[model samples]
Target: MSISVHLDRITDPIVAQDERHAGSSVRQPELRVLMATRYGRLGASSRLRLLQYAEPLAEQGILSTARPFLSDNYVKALYEGRSRLPAVLAAYARAPALRAAVQEHDIVWIEKELLPFLPALFERALLGANKKFILDFDDAWFLRYGGEGEAGGRNRLVRTLLGGKFPTLLRRAALTIVANETLRDWALRAGAANVLLLPTVVDLDHYPPTAMPTNPVFTIGWIGTPVTAPYLARLAEPLRQLSAEAPLELLVIGAPDFTLPGVTCRHLPWSEATEAAMISQCDVGIMPLPDDAWARGKSGYKLIQYMAAGRPTIGSPVGANTTIVEDGVTGFLAGPAATWADRLRRLRDDPPRRQAMGSAARLRVAADYALQATAPRLAAAIRSIAAR
Candidate 1:
């Protein structure tokens, strides 16, 4: 069943005119943006955000080109080669291609992960005209070197090499883009200037609400990658208990290894289209996150996706989840396994209420979070930086 809801037409002649005026007034600088990302794929959250800005920046005559530090081919080969020293060195040697690509762009945007090879890439990019560098980081990567709760200190080797590198890297950046106010504040405290708070956004056109299933099963769906797979495993027993009294199905997408007892588990392979289809089929989307430093830096893209698909999302009140979801209005925030069970049971019983909340969630995303609406703000920021 496909629900055909027309999104408000976002093409404003005035907006186009404003973009034209902005471009015409400012000398069309040969502003090329170099995005140095860990994963070079177009599908990742960071790459998507870069595309959102790039498309609009192009409209305003900014030439934005992304040079991903790591390519899928390299990663595939490295993993398939399995920890052989030669294979690892071959991967490390590919950093020069990224440095060469950096020469083509005027502004170098570094999505620096805590990887050893990145500093060399950073140093190489810094060689050319000391190009206007923009540092982008989401999570608390500095704290991630040591295992959580084992707080003596980070590994001596890692600490010696990377402990102080992030601060040094930030000191060199002309501008910075952070995921939220929390990150922005941290950057400021750390003495970084020109910090911009740009939260992760969705391609609303692609993620529109589909027709709702009429005889839909009361399915609690969770969609995430392999890294977050264990969180879904943690949900198994609570879902099992929930299924006892209620007609419940746990739809797990993207986690190929996830399995739950007594619950109808539908495990689908990970694909962009497949993930969207699976999400659209959900009655309620659940994002159960561990309340940790790493999870706090998450921009709540999963919740945004669920809400944009017109599915009421129940997520943990961590990081940007608190900002994205308005409890009982857009979706409920579950504190524990018991809360997760209660929220799932409540939504399962009340289909009409679920539909209403889903409708509200869609409206909320359209108003504030849609890429079409928010793209111009980002474009304006780029223009402002370029003008300087």
Candidate 2:
């Protein structure tokens, strides 16, 4: 139901609050942190926001254990367009166990809510008087309740019941960690008292900057799961236009069956073992998102990956993309409907410029979005919340 957060540097007394072992015997305070994640490792939010923090936090003597509401099977089913009703029901059935597991930990670091699609009253009641919890959000999850688009069209009763869910959780959390300024602003507006902006990051060790591969055709890369593949499809018109004028290859990773009629689209099954290497094969990277509330919540992780791989990026000028790409310096930010083709053309014709931009992009990522740079702060933040 839950995993225990073990502090290797601290004795058991701190967990028990035994003052006798607190003064000198303990090197560091022992704190058990429960990672109440939404989904298992297959979910990017859980993987990047919660699971990846385990090793980094352990380095600072804090051990974190995660218990996801939804299993990998649920995520796999969702990605494959299969029915997830069975998995969803199974997750809801496990809710009580997760609720009961909360009492055993010092702090609960939650990725989104412990349960989704339920009313906030029930979710809060499930948490049950525990104030030692931190909330993390990488997406504008609140938008799903009643903001716009499909969310606004939900059944009136469901919308009324769920619209205030995130705000209620935010106001109660000991701390709130958001992936970008957009999410941070939303949390602040929702009455969150203490908030921290921690962007989605790549481990620099795994994402080594490599020289662009010498290929016969210029390649533009995009990496994302099937759910996000539709965003990449927005560039079809631009890519189609570009393909007509030049030898272009659209390297799509993760979504193995993606295709564009006129463009030479190459699909590679995404694997951790080959992602970095696959990214290296690109001359440039692209993240094309529509301007919308849900899209605005994105952390621009695709651009970060591209930057880390020493490839210049061109992203839709929305949310984190505006901040991640330094316009003309590290990468370009163009409207998906406006200048995508023109921007792609610029990078295609200039090899030297691409190299220079890639270098700049990598440097920017190392300085700000690298996991190594933020791990200490993240550990400290969680430790501080646990101590409180």
Candidate 3:
């Protein structure tokens, strides 16, 4: 019944203690980290945060080499079929490639949702001398399959398969990193001894604020992937009501299927560079989500992107969004369409408040969640686990 099924070297506190004590002031090793990812580039939040930690890790003599497990064809199949099995198998079968990549590194870091197949490969590599394994995830992948509330039907099946594979992988990892307190708690309950909380971070320098455009129309934008595209429907009524009075434009980047009546909708193809630029052009950014378990696992990266771009964000009060948006200060957290409509109207009418909130959001991200500020903590965590 334990969440962790087979983790080695976790039960021995003495080993962790010995590794820490012996390595005190020993000048940490020049670590080479191998990262296994589904996507090859730093496009998504998970990949971006891992990349953000790389520069700091390098400063500490840690070099990271990333090897993407799934190909574009495999990912296309996953989306086209709306199933993860084929993608999962392809990732698992990439163990030979993963093993080859790890030979060039000292440790292996598996990003979220990849544990199902890669764990066996990781275990095989760990048997070698001086090789380490680190597991990183932002969501409760195990609970996604069969956990209670809002998860049903087809989603239940996906969750069940994911949950089964995740624990098996976690049990074999040397250390585990989770994004928030909720996920950390879940990992600990699953018997992951060295679970650490490492939230998603933004590159503050890359997303510096530009002068607000003196446009004739007020724009509200949303940026996310096709997976999260459906939540835009929740805002259809609110956006329609807002557009009834003002020149409100709705710019949706990455959601090809998204459309709204009475509001100007611009769908941009999903590219990291262009998406960031498109998001920067908006007057206000919106993050709307249904209250659900899967949504709760989101690390508020959308809000972080908006904040880093110095855009005031309006988000549904769900999961980490509530924690990121300091309601009424940095941004507003509205529950219903009526409240969403009211906030949009207020921001539309008041330019100064929007400017002030945008400034505050930028400051918040730079201080707490920027890569420069957060990477040290991540490095220290790696150092801790690596020593063990």
Candidate 4:
């Protein structure tokens, strides 16, 4: 679409004439945005929250320049179980340059905290209060700053120094974009002037609902990075039990070496190109998370991806998973007493139920969580913040 046509959809002729009369042109200058994401495309949080919207926002006259704190090498090293001390030091060294870069753009979109381990006061001094920046959070990273049950002296020091940092940033931000209601409520409690609940979404074009592939073995699939791979351990016993009763295999993507003691496992490296098709191969998708502040902050993008692929999901009824899965309708939510094995067995026995739920899950994603559904709102929000 042409820029003029885009402008016409958003701005009426009367408004243009009014602007012209007020000594301003009908055509506004393209809004330049500085996207300070924590990591490059390798990082899922930054990829889903900020980078994915860049092209769509650009088409709407909002151009963004993404500056990642950590490089792709940092992500690669982290995933490969290598020490990231050098990468951390390098990222900290490079962070200060962003303070000066803030003045070059109309609006700054910060993915999370500007500086890790630093107080908000220091960040304020570096960036200043004059520049308008949008603060975004897809996870409750603040929980790391001495949350509940931390008794160590080092934890106390961290809490004292950085506990209030997120609140300060939230209070001062021109707009705060969060991935789920848990984070949104946090921002509101922090006195954020504006809060937008923009869930992490998938591109429907990339994740088209296809007919479920026929497989001799029923596959229970999961995709996540190493940082989140530990959560899969929650399902180990359940999966092991299910493996005996059903012709099942655990298909693990992203975490290639993940395994279970009694269950058969197939691991595959995650690539953007294959993730959608990879998900479609599974009979069911699962996201198991502990019920904690940190887990509650998760955006449930994994569920969204599975739903978009026309696959039924079983997620822990914690955090955004509660909203993403429609319990008995679209997918099942494993509660505290709810056995994961029971849910898996039920879906395994009833292929028609799985197909019905998968179809409903796909429709749910298309309506609320797809990139096509949310991109316009994101672009408009960015434009609104820039205009202020």
RMSD in Å for all candidates: 6.9, 6.2, 5.3, 5.8
**Better lDDT candidate (1, 3):** 3
Model 4 regions lying over 4 Å from their true place: 1-28, 147-154, 336-338
Model 3: how far is 6 from its true place, Å? 25
**TM-score of each predicted structure versus truth:** 0.85, 0.90, 0.83, 0.90
RMSD to the native, candidate 2?
6.2
Query: Which TM-score value belongs to model 2?
Result: 0.90
Using lDDT, rank the candidates from best to worst: 2, 4, 3, 1
Better candidate number, 2 or 3, judged by lDDT: 2
lDDT of 3 by residue, 157-244 (tens): 5654443455555666677777666666667766665665666877777786786657868988788777677788898888888788
Task: Give me the runs in candidate 3 sitting further than 4 Å from their true place.
Answer: 1-27, 42-46, 76-93, 113-131, 147-162
Per-residue error for 106 in candidate 1, Å, reads 1.3
lDDT of each: 0.68, 0.82, 0.71, 0.82
Off by over 4 Å in 1: 1-30, 73-88, 113-129, 145-153
Candidate 2 lDDT over 1-388, as tens digits, reads 1112221122222233532333354577666788999998788889888888888777566778889999988989988999999999999888878866787778888888877888778867877885588899998888778744553537677678888888888888887888888887778878887777888998899986688878969999999999899887788888888888879899999998778888898989888778889999999999998888888899999999999999999999999899899999998999945588888899999999999999999999998898887776666566656665
* lDDT of predicted model 1: 0.68
Candidate number with the higher TM-score (3 or 4): 4
